[model samples]
Target: MANKYQRILLKLSGEALLGEQGHGIDADILDQYAEEIKAVQAEGIEVCVVIGGGNIFRGVKGATAGMDRVQGDYMGMLATMINSMALQDALERKNVHTRLMSAIRMEEIAEPYIRRRAIRHLEKGRVVMFGAGTGNPYFTTDTAASLRAIEIEADVILKGTRVDGIYDSDPEKNKDAVKFDTITGDEVLNKRLNVMDLTAFTLCRDNKTPIIVFNMNIKGNLKKVVCENQSIGSTVVWDQ
Candidate 1:
């Protein structure tokens, strides 16, 4: 089947890497994500990824614990690099071509982030993993994902989480919470749904980038969404 999106940016949470572990990454989860990504790439969709660092460290949590905000954020960035490297290794083990790029300079490990180079890599069918969260102290990886998606003109942002989709209330807590299969960006903002942070949401809203929130733990769902264009998750758009 032909892909609905030519290019996509996948946003994954660091906590998702925990995969039942107390802390740190789970090798099984890494391999599962790689396999999912490989399936999508095999369908000829250009893919890029941005992962968070909550499993290893979270800047906001550190700041609340009395650590300096800037220092905490930098530490969070490094944590993301660790996850990025792990995912890169998994993808390579599957024989998937990939490039690890970081906002911060670390020539020994990853290539510095270059917009054109990233797009070029995608054009060449290489999966690109963006790390270090924009190299800024205040921004979250969500913001980084939005920024990168816009810069690269990705067709959509796939937010892979444990939840199946966005809900009117917290599904984990509210038994009666309602889920919308498709929603306008304005509706998300008006309802104050906790999708992405405001900065990240605003960037996507202004750029008219669509976001799909889905359960990444589900096997074959990625391919179903990208390749089959099935409504396996909730989709956020500027308009219906």
Candidate 2:
């Protein structure tokens, strides 16, 4: 299939693993994720996925309660490892080739994040799921996605979320919110658009990597976004 994007980094929220339960990984949802990724693979697009560990544990939550920040963050990183393994198993069950590479080394279960190896995997048509959140504390998974995108020279970062697209206001709170068809990263900075955290926003902005915010729950959304086939999503790019 002819595609506009050759490589993509997909950022999925841990909450998404909950599917409809509004908590931990749901088996049915795992199956659906596997199916969606398989569909994306069928499109001949190299995909790299980054899954957040908030569903398992959120470091900031502990820090907020007075735990040491570094300790909490390390706990959060481990949480990501758990999610990564789950996803690896689910994707493999679908017969789709995948690799679980973590920022924090776990040689037995997965490979460490080596840029050259990651690029090699993409070239070989294997999906690489990155875990461990940049292997650092005081950092968000969004920043990790941006970092990997630049490392792999991905054409774009496909942010998988619960919403169909980005909005002028918080859609959850506001009854009438205007969704943007397309938007510039600079505008996002100017408007303080909370599509992603500021650190992540700056990384993509300065590096010239476009970000596509979309709802992964929409059947086939990931495939459509990666293939640049036009789906319900908000894109953040440079105006000039």
Best by TM-score: 1
Q: All candidates' lDDT scores? A: 0.97, 0.87
Top model by lDDT, which number?
1
lDDT for each residue of candidate 1 in 184-214, tens digit (9 for 90 to 100): 9999999999999999999999999999999
TM-score of each model, in listed order: 0.99, 0.96
In candidate 1, what residue range of length 10 has the lowest lDDT sum? Answer: 231-240
TM-score of model 1 relative to the true fold?
Answer: 0.99
Model 2 per-residue lDDT tens digits across residues 71-188:
9999998888888889889989888899889999889988999999999998898999999989999998988999999999999898988898888889999989999989888777
RMSDs, each prediction? 0.8, 1.3
Candidate 2 weakest lDDT stretch, 10 residues: 223-232
Pairs with backbone N, CA or C atoms under 3 Å apart (clashes), candidate 2: none
RMSD of 2: 1.3
